[model samples]
Target: MAIHLVGLALLMGVIISIYLPMITQTAKILGSGPMANIPFFAIALVSSIVIAIASGSRTEQFQKVATLPLWLLTAGVMSAGMIIGSSFLIPRIGIGAFFVLLVSGQVLAGMVFGYFGLFGVPASALTVGKVLGALLVIAGVYLVTFK
Candidate 1:
């Protein structure tokens, strides 16, 4: 569990490092001008795919592990659909409202999953403090962007 957590943290750090500087450099090139920001997003997407493939290949049971998810393709498809849908919806809703709703929903779903031990996870307690912290994060997002 500790190794898995460390791997996840490292993955997140690498992705963020790639994304932040790529977007910043794109902004510099565009000079706050009229060019679209798609290139930076494209670079990030390609980099993420490459990283995923590399990491996936490194597992001891890489081939078998990759094939085991055939039964849950529906869930995977739905997740991808939601990601694409969010890209379309976020601009329409505005960032503040979108983030508030998104993060709150994630925390609610996570709490339920954790408490119930869904998806093979062990049952965990969800205290009032955890819920309050989630709400505080949502409130902070709203305060930052809801001018």
Candidate 2:
């Protein structure tokens, strides 16, 4: 579990480094629109397909996908909105401020999602400690953005 967390963090850092520059460039060249996301999604889909094939779990994954609820499919929609929004906002706000705000929003949303057990995850009630941690995240974002 800890290794998975570390791996995910590393992957996220790499993706962010790649995404911020790429998306910002896309916005500059293409001007943010459905077209901007077209290449982004296309690349993501291709990459996913490649990874799925490389993992040799194509059949298992396809079976699992069939079992997944329709609501889970909305993740693509959410991802598109995030990517489009980031493409538009990062160019305007600067990556530092954009990431601070983005991370702050993610932290807050995660807390709420965990508290409510949204999307079928195990319920984890919001506690005082969690609230304090979230507040610190907001304070950190403010300090980074304003200071």
Candidate 3:
């Protein structure tokens, strides 16, 4: 089960990375301001609505959402920030560098979050391997970032 989940996670990671260039190009076309974020979210909202309707559990999901704290609902804000920031950075840094840096930061932050169990992530003791993996990611970012 764990191996299957890990594979699924890697697959999703690849998908998200592949999406970077698309958004970057859209940023170039739309001009990386409110214009970029607006259409992006509009599409996302529509897609989400379609999925929610198709789920056949829309009422249950809405009930679940209501039970959550207000702070939790602000995840959309974080998603917006990620898209807006990525729109600006991907074109400037180039896709490879932006993705490398993003993955590096995610790994490092994940290490901290996993160790401390922040944001409800299950606690895992930091090990030498985890730190080494993060260092390798940083090194990769450096290689991808510089000429």
Candidate 4:
């Protein structure tokens, strides 16, 4: 269990620490090229499709997705907006500020989501500790971006 937890942590860390920068740079470069965001995201979509098919989970995943509520289908639309926004914003804001603000927004939204048990997630009360942790994240973001 501990090993699995560590592996998951490492995976997330790599996504944030390494993958995010690479993708952001790719977006920036592609934004400057003649092709622009469409080709970049198209490639990403193709890559994801290939990976999903290769993983042999597509059948089960599609079945599950078919059963999901209509509102859940909007996730793809939201993801497209994030990808497009990131392609445009990262070049202007720089990765540091962009990620900081992105993470801050995610944390804030997570708090609300958890508090209200949104998206069928189990209800988790917003304790004082959670608020303090969020405040610390905000302060950290301010420190990182301003200093």
- On lDDT, the leading prediction is 2
What TM-score does each of the candidates earn? Answer: 0.52, 0.83, 0.86, 0.74
Give per-residue CA lDDT, model 3, range 82-111, as digits (tens).
Answer: 887888887677777887788888889999
Residues 28-118, candidate 2: write the lDDT tens digits.
7886655688888898899998999998868877778878788889998988888788778876777888888988888898888888898
- Model 4 alpha-carbon drift over 4 Å, by segment: 1-3, 32-68
Could you tell me the lDDT of residue 38 within candidate 3? 78
Candidate with more favorable, higher TM-score: 1 or 3: 3
After the best TM-score superposition of candidate 1, give how far the Cα of residue 98 lies from its true spot, in angstroms. Answer: 1.5
Q: Please provide, for model 1 over 1-147, each residue's C-alpha lDDT reduced to its tens digit, 9 standing for 90 to 100.
A: 699999998798576445444444545556531132456446657987689787766456645656776757677556444444444544466544655666667677888888999988788988889879877877776676574
Which numbered prediction scores highest in TM-score against the true structure? Answer: 3
How many residue pairs clash in all the candidates, one count each?
Answer: 0, 0, 0, 0
lDDT of each: 0.62, 0.83, 0.82, 0.77
After TM-score superposition, the amount by which residue 23's alpha carbon in candidate 1 deviates from its true location, in angstroms, is: 13
By TM-score, the candidates rank as 3, 2, 4, 1
In candidate 2, position 120 carries an lDDT of 72
- Cα-based RMSD of candidate 4: 3.2
**Model 4: clashing residue pairs?**
none
Instruction: Compare candidates 1 and 4 on lDDT and give the better one.
Output: 4
lDDT, candidate 3, residue 44?
A: 87
